[model samples]
Every structure is written in structure tokens, then in C-alpha cells.
Target: MGFRVRSPQDFWGGIVLIIIALIAIWASRDLAGMRGFAFGPGTAPRLFAGLLAFCGALVALVGLLQDGPKIGAYAIRGPLFIVAAILTFALAVRPLGLVFATYVTFLVSIMASKEMRLIESVIAAAAMTAFCVGLFTYLLGLPFQLWPPFMY
Candidate 1:
């Protein structure tokens, strides 16, 4: 079989997805599974994990067949800042509220890209923050504090 990886990113991404799915399956193994006519705690989780593995395999196969862009040099700044943004949002959401936390997170994550302009990023972040707040609080009907507790 003459197999060549056409999309290194997709190939590696699929491999990671498979590994994550395997880990999820392993972690849920101790939970109760199917018994007789009813589903158990682990049934849905294991089923989803199997589906994820299947999708990952499909992605890997596509990478092997289709031609795509070559892999570029890895950049730690992007991942690092993105993780930081996530952490910031998690830590600040309760204290700073949804509006502030979302904006801050967007700003932090935007810093990961070198080509992003400050003005454009700020505008985009504001728009995204408004959308998220509206979607979560109004559309989804979830109770999310929009502003700081002290503001009320």
C-alpha cells in the first residue's frame, strides 16, 4: 500500500481525536453498562466515544487520500494564549460576570494571532461578547449575570 499523508494537520488531529476518544472510553469503563432492557450510566458515554473514534478514523483516511497544504511550523504562542483565555474566562465568569469575562477572553485569545489588528480585534470581540451574552441569557433562557455583582 503506497500511502502518503497529504494533510499532516488533519492526520495528526485525527490521531489526537482517536487518542482522546480512547481515553474517554477507558475512563468510563468502570461505570455501569447496559443491563437487560435499560441503558446504564456508561452507555451513552461509551457510545459517543466509539462514534468519535469512527469520525477520527474517517478524518485520517481523508488525510491519506486528499492533497492539502503542507504543515507549517508549530507556534506555542497560539495554544498558550488560547489556554490562558479559557482559564481567564473560567476564573472570571462568576466574579466579573458574562459581559466582562467574555470580552476579556476574546482579547486574550486574539493576542495569539500576530496579524490581528488591535482596533479590529476590539470591535470583533465586542460583537462576539454581545452575541454570546444574548444567546446564552435571552435565547437559551439561561440565567447568566451580565455584569458585575457590585453593579446591581
Candidate 2:
């Protein structure tokens, strides 16, 4: 009997993850990892990449071995919203600053959920903004601007 993929989506997901992991490993290969006990920038990336690759392989193997449901229709809304949120954050962070950008990102991402409530989203946004400000600004002492230039 020919090999049948039990979960086409999971198998494909594994393949994509493996490909990404391979690319990461290749890109990080040239980065410095000095000899003997000296771990450089590449070390963590390589370790993570290796782990990702292994996990991807395991997922693929599981997909192959088990009988699973057929792949269903792909949903674009969640992914699109998440990408938009990330892009919004990247674009807004410099001009709008951390707190505003974080709030916007949280708000944008919340739209991806079908059961999203406005009040909950607002609360989440505020909490995320405060947490990010506390972590990056106060605890880590990062020099991120908290507000727009005009507000300063």
C-alpha cells in the first residue's frame, strides 16, 4: 500500500517548519561561536534551530503514523490580522512609541478572535501597554520612547 498522510495539514506544517529551521541554521552558521566554552551569538540560534527541526520531524512522523482527520479549509482571518498587527507595531513603534504601539498591536490582534469583546480588548491592550512599559522601560532600562515626540 502506498504511504498515506494521516494529517496533510500537520505534515505540511512540519515541512514548512523544517524548511524554516534549516534556513535559520544555515544563516546562523557563519555567526561566531568561538572555540572551547565560548558560546557566541550563533549558539542559541543553532540550538533552537536544531530543536525546531527535530520537533518538525517528530510532527511529520506522527502525521505519517496516525490516522487523522482530513485537512480542512484554511482560515485567513486570524493569520492576516496577526500579520497586520505585527506590521502595525513595526511601523508605529518608531513614531508612536512603545506604549501606543503596544496598545495598537494588542487591539489589532484581538480582532482576529471571533469572540472578541471590545471591553476585553481594551483592557488587554491597556494591560499589555503597561506590562511592556514596565518590563522594557523600567525593569530593563530600555531607552524606548514612551510617547510621540510632540507629546514630549
Leading candidate by lDDT: 1
Candidate 1 per-residue lDDT, tens place, 66-144, comes to 8877778988999999999999999999999999999999999998888879999999999999999889999999989
Pairing residues by index, what is the TM-score of model 2?
0.56
RMSD to true structure for each model, in Å: 5.6, 5.8
* Model 2 steric clash total: 0
Candidate 1: minimum summed lDDT over ten consecutive residues — where? Answer: 62-71
Model 2: ten consecutive residues of lowest lDDT: 65-74
Would you list the clashing residue pairs of candidate 2?
Answer: none
- What digit string (tens of lDDT, one per residue) describes model 2 on residues 1-152? 89789888778778889999999999998998756888788889999999999999988888888877777887999999999999999999999988889999999999998999999889888998898899989999999999988898
Q: Which stretches of candidate 1 lie over 4 Å from their true place?
A: 1-73
